[model samples]
Target: MQITNEHNEKMAKMTFSSVYPHYVAKVESKGRTKEELHQVIAWLTGFDDQKVKELIDEKATFDTFFKKAELNPNAELITGVICGYRIEEIDNPLTRKVRYLDKLVDELAKGRKMEKILRKA
Candidate 1:
């Protein structure tokens, strides 16, 4: 569920009102700061801080996150797309499930890969 540079570019062009919540969701779910989210947008879409802030202030939605996160066809990559520290790997079924869900939430927060995370399931 890798997001291509092209997809990231497309996301950057979306309206702020239409994309803000997604930004909020992504950052909040992953327990990341606005700065961290900014880094992710810069890494994945090449957007600067100003642009990332605009989106954060807009009316973001689940759809917006879905588009920005690029969930489809790149789910696998989401789990590995380092945020702050490395995503911890869980092997216990209960812990694994919880960790898996947390990781998925983290990825989706930024419109990330879902398949790689799913593979672990």
Candidate 2:
């Protein structure tokens, strides 16, 4: 599907809480822990465990979720394809943030080491 403005809008409006469970399930199924998943999330968006839980409890949309985030400076280093789109090539900033999280979760589920998944200088 073409990632038009409407598609970006739809993605931005997607509830982070609705997708959080699936992320937990995915990682756990692959023998990864929820703590590991949270670590990845913290590395990307700087949301602590408590804040994440609050967001989940409130069912915050991606828009609200990211707006509250102090995105990591290393986030732009998260490059690669996820969900068939090259994350670095994604023009919409919010959509890219969402995909960056997806990519981190994917890497965690795939057994990538934390050091590699959490990019650094």
Candidate 3:
């Protein structure tokens, strides 16, 4: 897919729920943690939902998604999104669990709103 600035905006706004499954499968099958998966996606596809899905659906055996980023330049922007954060900052368990639950919903009914699941309770 194309990697325009508008595309980057859309990716940055993508709720974790919409993109979590690809990472979940990778994490489970490859022994990578949540952060590791995100980092890989960030490095490879720049956070475009469609490209990330394509990469995951390919079942690449690499630890991170950097193996074939050239196939999707959109993933390059995803790397910028993750430039300085530590893995713990993004691997929020509570938020991740909520995303997993959202995954159960049908695509037509799924909420794309990015709620602050990591609230300071």
Candidate 4:
């Protein structure tokens, strides 16, 4: 399904903190470490562990969270299917960014190698 602006706006208003635990649980359930989850987030958004925690503590919305992000130049390298949607086919910029994070977390939970997940240079 194509992502609509309404969907993007709704997702943008969602709290990153509210969604963080699910990401953590998904990875941990698959035997991955919280550190690995943080690593992927940091690699994608340029927020270190401390900054990530601070954003969570502040209850930052996805819009606010991504607004502060310095997305990696290699973010374009993140390509795959997520929730039945192809990442490269997503048209909404914000939704694409959100899906990028989702795809990364999914990859981490699925035990994809860190180098591959990070799209190593």
Candidate 3 Cα outliers beyond 4 Å, as residue runs: 33-121
- Measured on C-alpha atoms, candidate 1 has an lDDT of 0.45
lDDT of 4 at 44: 94
**Residue-level lDDT for 60 in candidate 2:** 95
Q: Candidate 3: worst 10 consecutive residues by lDDT?
A: 112-121
The local lDDT score (0 to 100) that residue 110 gets in candidate 1 is 53
TM-score of 2: 0.96
lDDT of 2 at 19: 97
Candidate 1 lDDT at 10 equals: 51
Per-residue C-alpha lDDT of model 3 across residues 1-121, encoded as one tens digit per residue: 2234553444344554445676466445554455544444443335555666665576542323333444233211221122233222334333222222233221112222222111112
- lDDT rank, highest first? 2, 4, 1, 3
What's the residue-level lDDT of 54 in candidate 1? 55
Residue by residue across 1-121, what tens digits does model 2's lDDT show? 3589998999988999999999999999999999999999998889999999999999999999999999999899999899999998898999999999999999999999889999853
Ranking by TM-score: 2, 4, 1, 3
Which 10 successive residues of model 1 have the least lDDT summed? 90-99
| Model 4 per-residue lDDT tens digits across residues 1-121 | 7777788789899999999999999999999999999999999999999999999999999999999999999999999899888999988777889999999999999989999999985
Error of 1 at 96 (Å): 28
Clashes of each: 16, 0, 4, 0
Candidate 4: global Cα-lDDT? 0.93
